[model samples]
Target: MSIVRNIGAEYQPGKGTAFTVWAPKATQVELSLKSNPQTRVPLQREAFGYWTGLSEEAVPGTRYMYHLDGERDRPDPASRFQPEGVHGPSAVVDHTSFGWTDATWQGLPLDQLIIYELHVGTFSAAGTFEGVIEHLPELQDLGITAIEIMPIAQFPGSRNWGYDGVFPFAAQNSYGGPEGLKKLVNACHGHGISVVLDVVYNHMGPEGNYLNEYGHYFTHRYNTPWGDALNFDDAHCDHVRNFFIQNTLTWLRDFHIDALRLDAVHAIYDTGAKHFLQELREHVGQLEEQEGRPFLLIAESDQSDVRLINPINKGGYGLHAQWFDDYHHVIHTLVTGEMEGYFEDYGKPDQLQKALEHTFVYNGLYSEHRKKTLGTDATANPARQFVVCAQNHDQVGNRMLGERLTELVPFEMLKTVAGMILLSPYVPMLFMGEEYGEQNPFLYFVSHTDTDLVEAVRKGRKEEFAYFAAKGEAPDPQSEETFERSKLRRSYTSDPQQQKLREFYKALIQLRKTHPALAHPDKPHLRVKLDSEKLVLHLTHTGQEPHLYCLFNISNQPQKTQLHAAAGPWKPLLHSADTAWGGPGADIPEMLQQRATVSLPPASVLILELFA
Candidate 1:
């Protein structure tokens, strides 16, 4: 064994690179440069698994593999990027080689962003970074300000949700790997749209995970439903924390990404004094200061803890935004009447009014899902709060039969839900294929190298539905067919149903952007009136430049009632009941023509902007 392990190796601007690994237990580790016949160069190690070597003579295009224990060569555990597939060898890449034209590019602000979340593999037919660019014009035209992609980190297979990523820095080779991502970022910035990468720091994918050999990166002390928890608080945690921290910065700086959406932060187990999130926030803030623009860190957490956005001076992690699951639940329940499962706590028209009013339903209120009161005092900062159709991803895929909301709710009901979702005071997000109400379902599927793990996933899915076992029908989650069916039906534009849904979404988003009451995030002054026939909610922005939004979440029966809120100059911009355009068939007529004393139809959702 050699005496030195160069953790920080010397840099070569464009030439082939050198790498080192730290494997204390291993007797020998060799660096195999994949050139000509793929020759193996021996490595030297230090005391604590710090293996070092130099490939000064290797070319930039050479594909190299790390051979540990003097046996078969594996990919680098800390590979900066993956060009080939995950199973292939790690190629030498120069971080500064890619020319970026974003010198004047600052970044996107939190509240200003209308984010569209997409999974690269299914986003386009090509399923590569280049393929996604072809669809960028569609996103740009849709009035989206940023694109939030599911993780692209190298996993075991050609496709995944990216939460299972083990190589934190390496981009998935199947999705244009590293170089392709840089190009994507450049293209986005050129179009003045930011890219927010959805990253998973909670747990690594079970397959192609070689972190166990590199260092103490995972722990068995704390168990997660998904195998082992990441090592953030345990032994040798300082380095482990640094590992992830560095990874975040690399994504921002190296990949030219504007923001990171931390996936399932509720699952990130940390107990440090300067908590991991706080540290990450501090670093990101500093980077923003250096870059001189808005760089964001949004967290996907069901725990509606206000401290996540509290400034460091106030002892909070200072995340820019958070995904509000309550918002989605409220909308889902109202539109679909899905009273089973978690939807049991939602579906009431009042819940819709409350979510828009406060941004959280369970704000210390009793939750049937948790079987307890949830959240603390968050009424203090409702604007900084983010609410959305955020229960995307798993919500669409986890269904026993893998179905989307389009499968349940009528198109106009979907449009009404869209009005409420987009017009609310909090930030809004749309899931991939949701804009047009695509019929494909995103299912829970994985290609694990371990056969036993495959069977285990199958059994887990079958038993998960004892609540619906009485139906005597269960989805076959194990079959490759299940995975195939879950892909989005891309023929949305040509399909009549999808075309109408797309038009509805387009109008709703446009209304949100143009209308003053719906554009900003502020808890509006609210008046609720419910009679035997209908429920009407009148909303007014509280502060300066106040505006109004009125909703009639009525039933299928026509009714007209007087509202209690102060009469203001309100014009009906939209009504869900007028369903000549592919929705729940209800026609509330133009009796609402610029007048206070108007009519309402059953099961209608209406929006009228007001000026007081």
Candidate 2:
């Protein structure tokens, strides 16, 4: 494998631009510029199958492509901007052009994060990065410190969930492309909000993928659910790995992204002496040390192994955090009483208690859903290393009708569930429109240009949801109606129930930020007790500042639970069933003595702050 100082199109003011690409299989390569098919500049072959050349006429904003073997024209493999579309030519973008004002900005710590995940295409009426910028103030007002955006890489067409991205470095064309993304990041920093992008490095989208044509980017030896696995451990894999490492650095350095949430890292099959994830983590660490800025990497792994966040010296990958799906599953199953598919093993009340005290309930235990022993112990890791959410893109978009928790459970239960998520020991995340209880479903939608691929996707979606006997044919993935129906309705908050839900979420987040016991991210300091028969859960946090106690009754029956206070009085902080929150039930008493038995309303949560 050959290592180059820099790849892609690097531009200078009067010096024009330099172009470099790796195409070992091709005998020759030429650079085509500015919509002229006849204009071609031959590049000299360098060591290790690399083609390099400098064009005095090519400058920033100049559209170009690489002609392989003087035959077909293809976009740059590391293109920074694909304004026309994925199948169109690449445009040279000036990285230094955007005037960023966040010079002294330092990112927030992992433990202090309150993430709100969103898909740009469906987040607002504009369906662009500019549209998302308008809502950052509201999110910050809601006590969210970080905004986790779904994948934005260039895909086949206009609309997608973004897992089908083919261009690893290019911004999505329909979402205002590169300049728009830079503006969004700049605006976020102005409001003291950090941007965490969800990135997919597991596999490329099948449609309009040209990586294999330029070099051996994909390996046939390994397979993933999407397609062939990326060649991370094969011959000439050094540059392949460098391609991804450089892409990540481009986002952090050029676009000023605070963090990256790696998507489905368990699907990245690599068996080399030096693992790819470790190498990527070291690269990011070096950047952080060099620039003296915070850059976090959160992996989305299903293996349930704590090694993903463990220290590198301790034989681990050293990533900052991982997505905790088990926490969501436990809450979803226990709150909704659904026992099907992967949720078959999680409806028991004890499972939720385990998730509250520890990160995962399936750690080093038998999984009835998988029919095998799954996961390793996670008790040794801190609660900040896990990002827990009650609803996300996968948990809602993959369902038969794309129904949310608001549709499945009662309005009172929604507030109770929100309390459970926001007040937990782990970092909390909320799905788009979840805070306001928006009624529109987040269905899976795509806009692929290929007719054959579109039909195949529709057929596969129907077969995948066939297990749900009550549901019939799913909405067509290619239809415009599917994408339109998924857009978030900002006007829904006018309703009384939705306004109450929004206020309830805001209060919970505020409590999580202010309360001394709830602010900490230590699972060891937390205690959980679950009464399965009465469906009541009691959680306590023993701390020096102000002790905390929370009781939740998931069932629809009012029950009384004893509060075990230490020395002084306990003040009621929040009650989900109170009349102010659109509930018929009355509020809990203002004060409670030690060992007082309090009656909790049906399907409600009571949070108390113990005072000395």
Candidate 3:
């Protein structure tokens, strides 16, 4: 295994851009400037298959391509910016050029974020980084604190889900590349908003992945469909680990990203004494200490392991937060009746009650599908887990047809999920187009040079189970139409339901910001009452001028329910079934509001306030 002497070349910012690409077996490596052959410089690589060079003219916004031994032209896997798309030249950016005013902006703690996940391609019709920025005002009005962007790394062609990224360090040129992304981030921060970058470290894309030429970055001990596993625990693991860690910090330091949502951590597969997640957390903590800026790491794992989000001092990874699927499955099953695979395990309101109250319903209980007890509960730890209605890239792209929750659930149900997510103490997330209910679907896409793989993807989509396994007759992921369709329809911003939904979301977010009782979950204050088909969440805070309460009706029929509240001065704050949301429910107090008796319409949720 060849040692990586210059892993720093991929991320360290500067005027003289120095890049170190691992192409060990190749006889020669040349950095070719786009449309210019005279500037092609030969790389200086040692015995370890690592080729490196420092360029004085490779300034920010400059474009270039990589030529291997006078071979065919190829895009740089580490290209910083691509203004002309994936096939375009690499750009050199001065990470310090952009002035950021978030001096006191300690980013949204993962615990407090009402995350709105969006795909730049699908979030707007323009399908570019700059296009997505146009909707920041709308998102701000929609009551979102952070925008968790899907991967922006360069891939083979125009369209992709970003999971097929080959360029670990570069942004897609077609989407206006690095500068475009920086502009969007700057804009988000200007609006007092934070950004979270979704990074994939599990495996490289099938195409444009020439890293094998450098050294043993992958091990054959375990093989995934994506190919070799990253050598996280074996020999030459230090440099490989640094390669990822540096990329992780670069998003924070250069892009001003508040947090990183680590994708598919279970596939990260680090079997070492000091796990990569722990080390990464330590590095981020150190950076946070030096910069005096609050940053968070949100891990995506299905192991139901507490160590992923546990405190670092407790011999755990100490990540700030993690994605909770238990909450998603419960809510998805209840609303959509999608009990095919794993949803079969969570169709009951009782499941949602446990998820809403205790964080996880399957607390070491027997899972009928897994045929074993899943895992232990989060132990009443609500702050460490983020639950939400939808997140960009995952739910949208996971479907066989790339359908969003908006397509399956009614507008009223959308409000219901939004209320349930926002009112809960846990961090909430929303997918792009969810605020206004976009009609487009978020389909799985990719741009691979190999025609065989493209055909395989089309065939794969025709079959359904998980995302990659959807085997539907699909469009060519590399096609221009596919990429174009991913862009969000900005017109939804003006729709009536869109406006109404936006206000409701904003109200909930504002409520969360103003209320302390909604910040974190404690045992006594939070409790959920539910039947087989209906649920009512009752919450009360300690020590205040009043208390917090939210009543939810998950059934398909209007139901009259009773609650355990003193009901001295009770008033309805908001309802999902109001006429604004196209409901016929009346505002006239039911039973004089003395004992808090009210009629909840089908698939509706109500948030109430008690003034003591």
Measured by lDDT, the strongest candidate is: 2
* Ten contiguous residues minimizing lDDT sum, candidate 1: 1-10
Candidate 1 on 286-400: residue-level lDDT in tens?
7778767767898888777877887778877888788888778866765565788778877777766666666677788888877988775566665545747733777886777
Cα lDDT computed for each candidate against the true fold? 0.71, 0.87, 0.72
State the number of backbone clashes in model 3.
22
**What tens-digit string does per-residue lDDT give for candidate 3 at 1-612?**
222243433434544778776664578888887646777888897655667888777666667776787776666655566565555566666666677666666776665677888877777767888887887887887668899888888777767778877777787777877778888888898887899889998888877676665456788888877777988887767777877877877788878888988888989878888888998888888788877887888888777777887777877898877888888888788788888766788887777767766776777888898888876668556543655554456656766667778778887778788777777767778887776677777766776778888877766665544454444455556666766666677555567767777666677778877776665544446656665644554554432435666777766777777756655466666777777655565563622254656677878877666754
Clashes of each: 14, 0, 22
The residue-level lDDT of candidate 3 at 377 comes to 63
Model 1: C-alpha RMSD to truth? 3.8
Q: Each candidate: RMSD to true structure? A: 3.8, 1.5, 3.6
lDDT of candidate 2 vs native? 0.87
Tens-digit lDDT track for model 2 on 1-612?
A: 234346788887789889988888889999999656678999999877888999888887889999998779999998988888888899888997889899998999998899999999999899999999988888988988999999999998998999999888899989998899999999998998889999999989988799889998988888778777899988888888888988898899889999999999998887997788888888888889988897999999888998889999999989999999998888888778888889997888788888877677888889988989889888879999999999999999999789988899988888888888887888999999999888899999999999999999999998998877577788888989999999998765578878878888998988888888876757888878888888888888774368888888888788888875555488888889887887776657789887888898888998888866
